[model samples]
Target: MENRPLIGITTYLERARWGVWEQSAALLPAAYPALVQAAGGLAVLLPPDDPGRAPSVAARLDGLVVAGGPDIAPDRYGAEPHPRTAATAPERDAWESALIRAAAAARLPLLGVCRGMQLLNVVRGGTLVQHLPEAVGHQGHCPTPGVFTRHPVRPVPGTALAALLPEAELAVPTYHHQAVDRLGSGLRVCARAADGTVEALEGDGPGFLLGVQWHPERDGDLRVVRALVAAAGG
Candidate 1:
């Protein structure tokens, strides 16, 4: 049997209805797992669990993907909630935060998408812009609610991200109302939108730690995901 790299992906806990059951359920878009599988990895859904168990969970996997979800609690990063900020997910926050820390500790290959990207910054003692339109003077980043928009991000030359994405600028599916205001420790900006919104972040230290503000899964662009899978020795 082939030993595919195991990839753990974080999931959302929300009220959902299917067939006759209407209750809280562990939720994750199929695209996430699909992307991992396409990148030659074994997808594992990680439902919210006790934060203390993160180290054990991370130890069982070769790579980790922090799936996108609702906004994180502003208080996690020592900031008050903004009026336009979406409802925060405290439980998810704690669980994913723990997982991120564990993954970094173990030097596991890691990727963060959308909200996941924002959480990475917060986990490392950084701040967020909260509402982006007010700061950027435009709604192009996330123009329509629940609909992903397209915009170009300029990758900083000589970055891991830039190396993966050979193009000077790449348009991607984006949907976010907040962005990294203060970069996290041991992390550096790798890409940015035309408005200067931070689009991609990478670890300054070792490991395949990366956080992308855009939704690479939404477009089936496997370059980033494949990078992680390859880094995991898949």
Candidate 2:
């Protein structure tokens, strides 16, 4: 672990029910840290906090992972909330948005998963589809509760994702009702679902900035995490 980079993972502040407890807590799936460690990096949980502290935090981290969670407030991107959109977490949105900005400013490597990807897009002047089924016809993008729908996505050749997965098609674990609609500023689409939903994208800047609609960590897909840690080392 000598050269292990310190990677900060953003968490969700939400209500949970556990053994004799039901209250709001900062939570993140264990898969995130485990995958990061498996990729040879020190994992740190970054719960949403004061916005003013984000830049300093980004300056100290080797990399950042915007973990997946609740829906973004539609108003953040100048849209009305869809009925299917979950309750908004404005504070979390504000904090994570700040983190994204700081990471970009510092040119820190970052990976955004699920809701994380949506927020990253919105924060960068991009828009979201809000509900994928309405636009894509199939709920295969998010088939069932507590289960990940598997689907093939084609990566654009010569993209960072293509380097990791050279196959023409990659089967990914995904569970999301929303997808990226408008392309974000300086962001390039790296992959797309069979139905044409954007599956992954990367920023045009110099550092590693990837956002995927799939849950790579949940199923031990290490390519993306490994790439991020490698970039952090550089």
Candidate 3:
């Protein structure tokens, strides 16, 4: 793991309060960067910037990570917003979507979590279920807010995710109302929950392109994050 790869992770451009700063701030949970650093990658924050700069940002990083955030606007995928869709982050949607495209074009090792995962699906001409509880008839995937729940996700055999996480089933940190609906082009569903939620995806393109509905940063497992760093180093 010499020559630690530099990884750029997207951030949340939202209002924050810390030490008298109650204004808009580029923020992300420390868990994201902490996980990257623990996995031997230098973590850098990629805040909302002009979408046009995504290519240049992608070119400068060894790997890219699209972190979780608010729900994407339904319009992005040709759908109307569901009542539970909540407020959307159009700015983040535009910026991170651009970054995802840039990363794909460059074949940069990429990982998308939660909202990022949904965006990956949408960017690839796919769609999402705006409300998982409505579709699955249960809220286990996200039973609470500001908290990470746990749910079992079985990896599809012979998939890259299966090879990386050899466990028969993984209980992952979950917190998202949306899930992938239509399968995205050039991407394969790599894992699923007992209730049939798409939990993970992998692309057929070069390098590594993975999207997981759960939050690996919240878990102790480093396999997934390490894999991204490994691919980046190569």
Task: Please list the Cα RMSD from the true structure of every candidate, rounded to 1 decimal place.
Answer: 0.8, 1.3, 1.2
Candidate 3 residue-wise lDDT at 6: 96
Using TM-score, give the best candidate's number. 1
Residue 136, candidate 2: C-alpha displacement in angstroms: 0.9
List TM-score per model, in order. 0.98, 0.96, 0.98
Regions of candidate 1 where Cα sits further than 4 Å from its true position: none
Ranking by lDDT: 1, 3, 2
The regions of model 3 sitting more than 4 angstroms off are none
Candidate 1 weakest lDDT stretch, 10 residues: 81-90
lDDT per residue (tens digit) for residues 67-94 in model 3? 9999999898999989889745788999
Error of 2 at 230 (Å): 0.6
Sort the predicted structures by TM-score, highest score first: 1, 3, 2
What is the Å distance of residue 153 in model 3 from its true position? 0.5
Per-residue lDDT tens digits for candidate 1, residues 1-234, read: 799899999999989999999999999999999999999999999999999999999999999999999888998889888998785578999999999999999999999999999999999998899999999999999899989999999999999999999898989999999999999999999999999999999999877999999998999689999999999973
Clashing pairs in 3: none
* Clash count (model 1, backbone only): 0
